[model samples]
Target: MQNGSSLSIAERGCFHTDKFDDDGKIKRTGTWKSATAHIITAVIGSGVLSLSWCFAQLGWIAGTVTLVLFSIITMFNTILLTDCYRSPDPVTGTRNYTYMDAVKSNLGTFQYKLCGIAQYGVLTGITIGYTTTTAISMAAIKKSNCFHKHGHNADCHAHNNSFMLIFAIIQIILSQLPNFHKLSLLSAVAAIMSFTYSFIGIGLSTAKIIGEGIGNTSLTGIPIGKDFTGMEKMWKTFSALGDIAFAYSFCFILIEIQDTLKSSPPENKQMKIATATGIMASTVFYMLCGVLGYAAFGNDAPGNFLTGFGFYDPFWLIDIANICIVVHLLGAYQVLSQPFFGFVETWSKEKWPQNKLVTREFSMWGFDVNMLRFVSRTTYVIVTTIIAMIFPFFNEFVGLLGAGTFWPLSVYFPIEMYISQAKIRKYSFTWIWMQILSVACLMVSLVAAVGSTHGLITSLQKFKPFQSVS
Candidate 1:
């Protein structure tokens, strides 16, 4: 068997591949480039916006160090799981089509169900968070326009529910698209939008510093001053760790992304390369945005550089950046949600093999339409949109999700699976070292979880649900 070759004995043919691919599915046309686009679309999201504030809390040394450290950790674990894309053989064995499939193959059937719960839970939260973030970005544009037209001091509060509805309607239509194989163009466009807005943020930050000399900053971070107490500083530093963790949270869908790639060149190898490239590209942007923003505002940096009135003079540029955020999130929502969609549909089909509504696809106009997919997906979008309209708190919850799942999904499970898949001897130096790394990461996750919890609590204390703030 060579590249793109699928060979199985008569007994295993039905399970391995119908003819070309495992499970006789459609052709996997994803390339490393498209995979990179998907990764970028998922990783470089609204989380990047708060990096400057994280920098402000952790300062030049720890801030930059944390960003790079997370990138390395993320890349390492991603490569570990990427190698598990196929079972019995790293490259040519039966495909583990989903994260749960990989878990079941390497770990066990019981762990497979837990992996589904964790992975799908995180992804569901992400799609809901994206809906809120996109709506907020849209509202920010309206707020910016309103503030510019009216005086800044005047009351300008843009309603968010209507904007959320606009997003939901657009998503309902886009959701009709079958799967990730058809989403390469959208992912590429979203990747471009992410880059555009990120560059705009960097440029704005650089311009501000050039216009006005650097603000007061310390190597360690904001020093204890009258306005900022020592206790608050400690909490902010821990919370900043959570923020940085949230910035690199694409591990939730790494396997599914790999499943989309072609068999040639080995999907594991291609995914490893894409993981490195995507993490490096995103890290560079994160450094620039965080460092430049901190240089501009220093201790007084806003949580979101674009939406927090950092540069009100260049109104049009701000509008464009916000619009880019909206566009990027539109694609990100799908990139993050499609795996969850695939999981549910796959389960339903297994349960109801005889139900046409559950498994049948009919050609409509120019597209293939599955009645179950249409109803379920549309209902999902509407439900998430309604939740966004009600609660609408995005960052803290996403940060919490990142912190809570980072150890299990990004570090622990991957390392454990790698050890089992590779059959590393017990108590060997390699196994012990990997275990040590997992424990260390678990401790770090706990710290981040505490920080995220505190932040979410503080935010809720000022609680007014469904209220839009400028």
Candidate 2:
């Protein structure tokens, strides 16, 4: 039970070694540093881009409250899932097994499949969502003449559309390549870039707020009857809380969590610490941006707005935000695609010359493994791109996707997993509280998801209902 202790229980005689691979492979044990990095990568992503939008909706006060509440709920679930791995299996060991296995062991096949569907669906949705976001960012940053409607205002639509197409193509081709290790450095870069942009955005927003008070010139004449100035301002501040809740619901990031928690030196404590820090950093960033953006734009802020405050030309900030977001999305896709592709490859027993997991590594058996990867990668690219293009028309459709897909997966599933396992049953009071709190958070998240989806639908009706923007 001690650090790196070697013990063989009769139930788990197959996994009595201290040395291990991160994914529970029977190799070298992973160190704490890898676990920390993985955690950071797992939590940081395009979620930041949407934070401002959420803040605009819910107001800064409610937005802050939502962030805090969701962070606590999410961390609670993370700790619970990590604890589930305490009783390591002999065959798969502790470092490499997944939640699927854990759920299967506790629940029946039907429930397990249901849980898998939730997990897989959320992961796929987020992957596609981020992919689309990435394409949009790249396109925005690399504005082309074809789409540039104005001489001074470069139109990024055409270029972004083209880049998205090519990016999808490249992802499909590279997916056929089996070197997942290459993504490690990319993931780290993505984490840093995302964090930097979010942090910088926050800093800028904070400075603007402190320099120029929260009162808006646009609202100077608007009468707030019977309400004192302070009360009216407080109400205005709290208006964006729902948006914050909606944003937090989408934090059901799956791939990075799996990678971090499953790496060669799986240190659960280190991962928890890193994730906690990331969430805290993100909350502060969101609050700062929300407060400043609201002050600067006064209710006219863009839905996906990040840095648009106190700048002579706000376009540069948008461009920077776009670049950082695209990188973040790539990292997100890289992480999400791995387990999905890996699962498919393992299921098909794929083996290839270039990609052993997917090609015909051994022709003696006349089995071609790589065929599945080629097909899957191509299909995913084509299908996801089409879906992405179609869905972007719906105002905040991607944000809603995050809420619908991830809220349940990130918040509900973990609670369900823990309850099913019953490891904490001995602590009756704690167990009851867990159930109450889990259900409460789940209900709030569920409402936030549904309401946000409805809001998107209403907004779309006012925009270009069922039609592409182009």
Which candidate ranks first by lDDT, i.e. highest? 1
Q: How far off is model 1, as Cα RMSD?
A: 3.4
- Per-candidate Cα lDDT values, in order, are 0.84, 0.54
How many residue pairs clash in each candidate at the backbone level? 0, 29
Tell me the tens digit of each residue's lDDT in model 2 across 1-470: 11123333323455534644333343432333444444455555555555555555455555556667777776677766654553343224343245565556655688668866776676676666666667656655544232333544444233345666766876775565553444666667777777777766665555566876554423332234565355544333322333454344423333234433434334455455655666666566556665566665544555555522323234566567667776666665766666566666665552332444444443334533355667877787777777766565323455455555445566666676667665567458877787788677556655556555556566656644223332
Which residue pairs in candidate 1 collide?
none
lDDT of 1 by residue, 1-470 (tens): 11212333333555334335554554577889999999999999988988988888999999999999999999889989898989868887888878888899999988888888888888877788788788778878887777788867867777888888999999998998877888899999999999999999999888889999787777998898899899888777777787788789888788889989988788998998899899999999999999999999988887776887446556788899999999999999989889888877877887888788887788989888899899999999998888777666765776677786788888888998899989999999999999998998888888878877887899888867677555
Off by over 4 Å in 2: 1-32, 86-96, 142-160, 177-182, 203-266, 307-318, 350-359, 362-369, 393-395, 420-422, 459-470
Q: What is the Cα root-mean-square deviation between model 2 and the actual structure?
A: 7.1
Cα lDDT, model 1, residue 181: 80
